[model samples]
Target chain A: QQQVKQSPQSLIVQKGGISIINCAYENTAFDYFPWYQQFPGKGPALLIAIRPDVSEKKEGRFTISFNKSAKQFSLHIMDSQPGDSATYFCAARPTDSWGKLQFGAGTQVVVTP
Target chain B: DAMVIQNPRYQVTQFGKPVTLSCSQTLNHNVMYWYQQKSSQAPKLLFHYYDKDFNNEADTPDNFQSRRPNTSFCFLDIRSPGLGDAAMYLCATSSPLGTSGYTFGSGTRLTVV
Candidate 1:
């Protein structure tokens, strides 16, 4: 199955609040997980990523928390700002798939002032 | 800085007409990808190129075809543009399939009339 499910198809948060988006996968062969951020009319850019070996990874205001046993991972945005309003996607792929990323449905995050 | 570049940020096509989208990368990555994203939905991967080798997704439509002339240039061709084919086409690049997240071009928006 090449599906990665993401929850809260849309999210709304206040400035300086915390934004959380969750994703789940069915394939245990997926060892790499990454999150992408896309602005309107633009291509997606890698925001943050994590491997099963690490439970959590934080870069700047973004963080990825992974649970290998549960086949789930989440993106957490700290000190959310209006500039962060955009679409967020979670993707996973097996080590041998050669960069074929199975992507989630995506989360439309809106940070209101 | 290393990045991906796409030409013609927007495209307008008529029914039965064909259109081509281009993407180039300065990163010198060995892999390139094409994706389609409709409004309010997550991006869907259509296919990718690992070096000079191409990998096609099983569900990709027959109307869609791709060509990679060299390591840095890739093209997405829609033989017959249809209303359903109107969406944001994104191009991405990475260093081999097993590598980390990719760098993406701004994308081309297609509108079929």
Candidate 2:
């Protein structure tokens, strides 16, 4: 079973607009949530992450709002830019595990100029 | 700066032949992981090494195996690859210290003819 499910397999947004991607999980044991951004022909890099203890975490233009009760989380990018166009992934794992991760099907975000 | 590296970004092999993908890290992370991702699919964890201990996912194929010769190097070996195995293989490393994020290497694209 897919532990994490993400929506909008592909999305297109105009520059300077807000971009949002959502993910839901089935495992309640997962406490750490992380989002990753990947470019073509490149590896994925950590964009932002949030622990279940916190409701929201923001860094620069990227924000991760987590709803622990809902077992859902989302990534919001404010004032989107073309540089932000890429694949975004939401992943989760149990706090006690090592290396075993469950990832959401990625969302391909395109910010058009 | 420390980084994770994957060798031979792309490989093509015969259906019944064996293939190996290598990953190395300079971050001195105690944990290393391997993931398989098909087109537009989420990354699925195959296995991982925590220090000297190895952990494998339940559904991972018997054709897949892994070896970690030392702290910085890990290898993924496929014995007689199938066409369905053609996908992007990602390698990642992390320190068991805490809830911090893992560093990922540019994936190795494996194709079986």
For model 1, residues B28-96, the per-residue Cα lDDT tens digits are 999999999899887788988888788888999999999999998999999998899999999988775
Report, in order, each candidate's fnat: 0.97, 0.71
DockQ of 2: 0.68
**Number of the top-ranking candidate, with DockQ as the measure:** 1
**What local distance difference test score does each model get?**
0.90, 0.90
DockQ values, each candidate: 0.84, 0.68
Model 1, A53-79: lDDT tens digits are: 999999999999998888899999999
Off by over 4 Å in 2: none
TM-score of each: 0.96, 0.95
* Worst lDDT 10-window in candidate 2 chain B: B94-103
* Candidate 2 whole-model C-alpha lDDT, 0 to 1: 0.90
